[model samples]
Target: MVALMCAEAVILGTNSKDYQIYSLGDRIFCCAPSTGIERGIMLEISNQVECQYRERGIKPTMDQVRDMLARKYENVSSENVLLVGQDRHGPHIYAMKGIGIPQTLIYAAKGKGRDDIIGYLMHNWKKSLNLAQAEQLVRTCLLVGENDYVNMCVIYKEKETWAKAVPQLEPVAIMAYDTESAFDDMTSMGSNLSN
Candidate 1:
């Protein structure tokens, strides 16, 4: 799974398992999966994020990297998230989703249950009143998947500060931050996994 935030160009997404934040020439090249774990996640996440940016003068980058983690280890997977906008008040910060933008910042648990991520995020919202403190408000959130009980999380203090995915084997190994990093990851593995 993958995620991104800009508070710049209005966070958009091109969800792909093989994501690699590439630093090409004048422009950075983003090569992520056109399809994969991020199947529906991208469309839904992006639309919501964009809506949050509207009327707020907040713009997310189209080139921002998505995904929580990237790994070269064959057994490692990853989950990712990023922030893009400021708080309703302009800098202090708040979640894009919590601030009346329901889908902008989604945090769904991988286990069994409906919208566990939503419930978890809402809980944090009330506790901290600030995404920063709210994010730190970690809980042993659980979800029952068909085959496993995954405990996942997505914490964001603002548009720029966030921690994606819990620790289900590190999610998808979201790695390769910059262009160089993406290049190395691609050359090393050649598998589907990027920013």
Candidate 2:
């Protein structure tokens, strides 16, 4: 169904307590959970933003980009996240609903267990977190939940006057470890529990 699946992006706003922690012109990176059909939507939206920026010699505002996506996507359902550059403003983060609603996220995660993840953030999120700290918090939430449903992590940061193309991170295995190796930990623990 081309349902836009899961994409995660974080935007620390002016009101954010950790805003001052990051330098003035850091780049905002948009990450797609995995390379697949679902990731296509995010790519297209980003492409559109880039095209508009190139033609206009200015980055489109979130609202403008949102409208463009809404028109292009029409009724297609899918998961999408965008952290495109905002002209003079800092980076803007948004999740585009299949129905074309560009919902802004403030330290929010989308996709499976989105509700629970949001709740978790509400309880544990701190205002003093820097960019890296915020990213770690998101990573921790996914890891602690053992959310196998999501497998993609992308980082977004805004730069000075122009938006730099943030690179995708190398894929890594998500594992639960208690100092023991994978096979050793699971098998040994299994035997003990059964006994």
Q: Which portions of model 2 show Cα errors greater than 4 Å? A: 1-40, 79-87, 147-195
Off by over 4 Å in 1: 1-102, 105-112, 127-139, 142-195
| Local error of candidate 1 at residue 160 (angstroms) | 11
- Best candidate (score: TM-score): 2
lDDT scores of the candidates, listed in order: 0.32, 0.49
Tens digits of lDDT, candidate 2, 54-116: 787765565665576566557665454333333345445556655656666555455545677
> Which TM-score value belongs to model 1?
0.24
Q: For each candidate, what TM-score against the reference?
A: 0.24, 0.51
